[model samples]
Target: AEFEIPGYLVWGALIYAIFGTALTQWIGSPLVNLDFQQQRFEADFRFNLVRVRENSEQIALLQGESAERQRLSERFGRVVGNWYMIMRRTKRLTAFTSSYAQAAVIFPYILVAPAYFANKIQLGGMMQTASAFSSVQTALSFFVSTYRTLAEWRAVVARLDGFETAIKSAAAEAISTSSIGVLSSAGRDNIHLQKLLVNLPNGTPLVSADSFTILGNQRTLVIGPSGAGKSTLFRAIAGIWPFGSGSIAIPAKATLMMLPQRPYFPVGSLYAAIVYPAEVGAFSSDRVREILIAVGLPQLASRLDEEAHWNRMLSLGEQQRLGLARAFLHQPQYLFLDEATASLDEASEAALYKLLEKRLPRTTIVSIGHRSTLEAFHQRKVVLRREGDRFVLQNQAEGVKSSSDAPLA
Candidate 1:
């Protein structure tokens, strides 16, 4: 035998690679699940911070600064607590990987040293044997070196899978529900609800009407007790609430707008907010200032060009005035109000309604309010009364009032 070099080096390198990869997988498996929780907890904490900033004014008004601070602290604590677990897991993983890497350097020499001492191989032959062993070990331990990256990738895949599943479920539900069909009509001058039944997302009936019609250019007021599905009815009419049965035929080429009690204004210039749902330059600056003054917000007229968070900067009563100002600017054929003036006093409420009557004489107005003073502005009144599990609409007797009895604007 020229050298009698042993083949144990080759077999030893393969065994070490297999053992190291398997151990690394076992130790790092928990990291995949922890990474997912850490991401969610961190995202939740960030979202809570944004929510606090958005509602900063309300929190200050309620003097709930300490409560909000405590809530934020609690949410942040979860983020920190989960991060600590990730760090510990990573620490353990690093310890094993580092040891495994160092051992591979000296391991080949240890296997070939015995053969060199027995005089079975020359120094050059022993060096070649060690180099070959090193190459095999490196190839086998590839997974061991990249274990952390694989864990993170697994977590990302899981989050994306959950998001995709949720979207598929919502789309499927929409396709399956064939009721609450919405049809648009061009020649008609009224809104028609035929065999309509509005229901909650859980299938509980809210409001039912066999046939209902809102004629063109009419002032109609809807009155009902608390939780009588008054707002839900408006949502259905707007073609947004889908948990219902029957068809809503809307006039074609007609514009409809809904004003809630607390109207939303985007964070931008007051001029932009005033003509929102309308493009910028839709109305002249002079026209916007004039409408602002007419709505009793003369102070804001000068600040039309000033950019601010108008919703947070303005009071509820002031916001309602701005809402009416918006209605005046847009002048849609139908304006639906859902307790849109609840924050204003009785006198101010009457003045706004009078302004609407004078400015939008042709626009059909529908209002939901509990106040008796609102009755004087509308020509017809309707009420929603509970009939079994759902509410049915009842048309009240038409009240007649001369122009002399109306409140002056």
Candidate 2:
């Protein structure tokens, strides 16, 4: 009778554990995908809030606060909707798991109670059988109690694996023969491009240039119709865009600086913003103040110690002026400006150009702009014309007049 009771209790615990584990798995499978999407939705909602904060000035100027608020609320709604689904699923899972645990404790006792009553076993034997049965059940039911945690772990692992794969693929392509290649040359006097083809990230051809040279001390302006891949060419030269074929050779040990339409400023003192990309205090405060005054930001000179979001607080024109001020401080060998002065008026733009010419006489300036006034500042013009599916660079020097000779018509 003792042997029979022990065998029966052991079999009962094993069957119970197997059934509970299978049920838990079936109920928890959906939670893995749900948790993955929940994380994505939450990240999206938070990113939207950050975007709204970054562009708050533009939204306020366009009186789009209500529209922005609606968009943000909708993003939050997605997060909340997904979270509710997770909660419902989790609640259902919890109910099953809790009942399974409680039932496990009582199941062993019920299986052995008949033997004790029938004089097949004493109280001690009954208690020992229940204890042995509980240990077996607990050992086998580990999955039932930890299924939710395992599902969450699986989702996290999948996300990390995807991220690592993307990073590796990008790194591989950066050195691939089919991608835009940036080669370094020993000379420090000229930038050269040999049969270079710059493409969009989707493998669509964007810009093509062949045997082009931008010499030191040259002021060149790049122009084209909208979407002609003007800014993209600059990106290719900077070795950041890696979606096309051919080689771009740059002078070795040369400093290159790119100023965009909207310059980014770190949230700190004016001195740091002006001398950015350089260590703070790299240039003396006196020098930074002089450049600020040169760029027509004398009012800012006195506020070098003030910390604020200069990009949002100051006007775009003011930001452009600061960008030029930074360039003046760095004195890079090659400077690429993509509509850097579009925010300023022609008068201010001309003055800034003059400041560059006076201060950075040896720095080669390659500018992308639509304003006719820009042509006056450049000694040469590089035009990008649509050719089949790509825009080809055509260097023009005929009738190319300096700003001092004739203003651009």
* Top TM-score prediction, candidate number: 2
lDDT of 1 by residue, 123-178 (tens): 89888887888888898889999999999999999999999999897666555555
Structure candidate 1, residue pairs in collision: 185-252
Q: What is the lDDT of residue 381 in candidate 1?
A: 87
- TM-score (C-alpha) between model 1 and the true structure: 0.86
State model 2's lDDT. Answer: 0.88
The list of candidate 1 runs beyond 4 A from truth reads: 1-18, 56-63, 107-142, 400-404
Q: How many backbone clashes are present in model 1?
A: 1
Candidate 2's C-alpha runs over 4 A off are 1-11, 114-118, 406-409
Model 1 deviation from native, Cα RMSD in Å: 3.3
lDDT, candidate 2, 174-282, per-residue tens: 9987998888899878888888998888888988987889877899998899999988889889999888988988988889999999999999988888888788879
Steric clash pairs (candidate 2):
none
Q: After best superposition, candidate 1 residue 64: deviation in angstroms?
A: 3.6
